[model samples]
Target: MRLEKKVIIVTGSCTGIGKAIAKRCVAEGGRVVIHGLEPELGQEVVQELGPANAVLHIEDLATEGVAERLVAVAVKAFGRLDAVVNNAALVLSSNLHTTDLTFFRRMLDVNTLAPFALIKAALPQLKQNRGCVLNIGSVNGWSGEPDLMAYSVSKGALMTLTRNLGDTLHREDGVRVNQINPGWVITENEARRKHEQGLAEDWYKDVPPVFAPSGRILWPAEIAAAAVYWLADESGPISGQIVDLEQYPFIGRNPPKN
Candidate 1:
């Protein structure tokens, strides 16, 4: 396995992309610390990932001291930290004109600030290990989304943060910082639940082809593979790059399934 003996932390492991990342890391022989808001569910994931490779830490990353605390736990339990995937985010579908200051602030606080703080907290350890960081960014980060204005701003800030940190650390600390901008993935559980809730049968039909002419929603496992590639035995000059999860147009390809 490529990530044998590596130690990584993935936030928001309760659901969606975070859960997929955690599972993939463990399967690749990495030691992963899965963070989620719910402890029981997190533990279930940890157990499924097997005894030695996975552990769960439940906490809200947006809390004042949570970043530092999570870092401490990783160091204390795993002995070293090799990578961090900042996957936690908050989204609100609201018009910017009517959205309150509090609502906007909350979006920034959880989506942008928490990731920034956590990366900083994990920086020294990553430096010590000469490790890599993969931020879970968004397509909306580069292109503005009218409905998700606050969320878009937060993700945009995160993309800029990734570039800034990647620039500084690649030269000085040997810590590679990159981001993944995933398009859309429909999980089986979510799809089934939404179907039960009377959701449209072909709602995703309207979403952009996501850089690829092929009209298919990107899978959670697709994003997981990208994370593994970054975390694994990768060589070559890699820094400050945004690995677009959406396929490039006319290539007729899927992302590297490491």
Candidate 2:
């Protein structure tokens, strides 16, 4: 029970990595506020975690004042806020020519700006409790594939935000901020996305070793396991760090040639 008695707010908790983290928090004895746009899915997650361990809040992160509402929900349900996990994102595909101003702005609004808003809204409580913020980013933030221009740009900006606040907040307010950049993970949406892109239903099963060194990509539960450390007191005084959760070294790696 690393997070015993702590109260956390996890955005996008209706599915994928966010749901996994919420489940893990409950397993570790932490209560959570589950936030997402899907009411049905959010209710399901809240049910799965049980009413005593979770509360549901449905809202689009891009909507004005949604961040403040999420913070309010957490405090109302649990009486206090200990941490926040910014796991929601818009993962749309677009290239230089395909991504227009509107599309790019939408991506940034949801992916980057929303996290900043939530952090700001939760700042007072976080500082009072000496709590933390964990931003879920993507490995593509470093320099993404050609087709992921807007998404990549948004994630890169999020990375910078994480580092900047991680340092300043820890120094001034004693609230730690950090980030985790995950590689491709096998989530429900990812499977459906691959099928829509014309891959076989079992495409993930035969992923190339270059992409899946362990013969498979990551699982949401695996990422959740790593998240526990940062949320718990065991991580002591560490802030402003970005950890890349991938099977192999992401930078300066040479794949074998046939």
Q: Which is the leading candidate under lDDT?
A: 2
Off by over 4 Å in 2: none
lDDT of 2: 0.94
Model 1 regions lying over 4 Å from their true place: 188-198, 201-215, 247-258
Sliding window of 10 residues with minimal summed lDDT for model 1: 249-258
lDDT of 1 by residue, 1-258 (tens): 888889998998877789999889888888888898888878889788876777778887778899998888788778999999999887556676868999998888998899889888998999898898889988777765677788888888999988998899889998888898876567644465556767786655554544335666777888898888877757445888886676563233465443
In terms of TM-score, the best-performing candidate is 2
Total clashes, candidate 2?
0
lDDT of each: 0.81, 0.94
How does residue 88 of candidate 1 score in lDDT?
82
TM-score of 1: 0.87
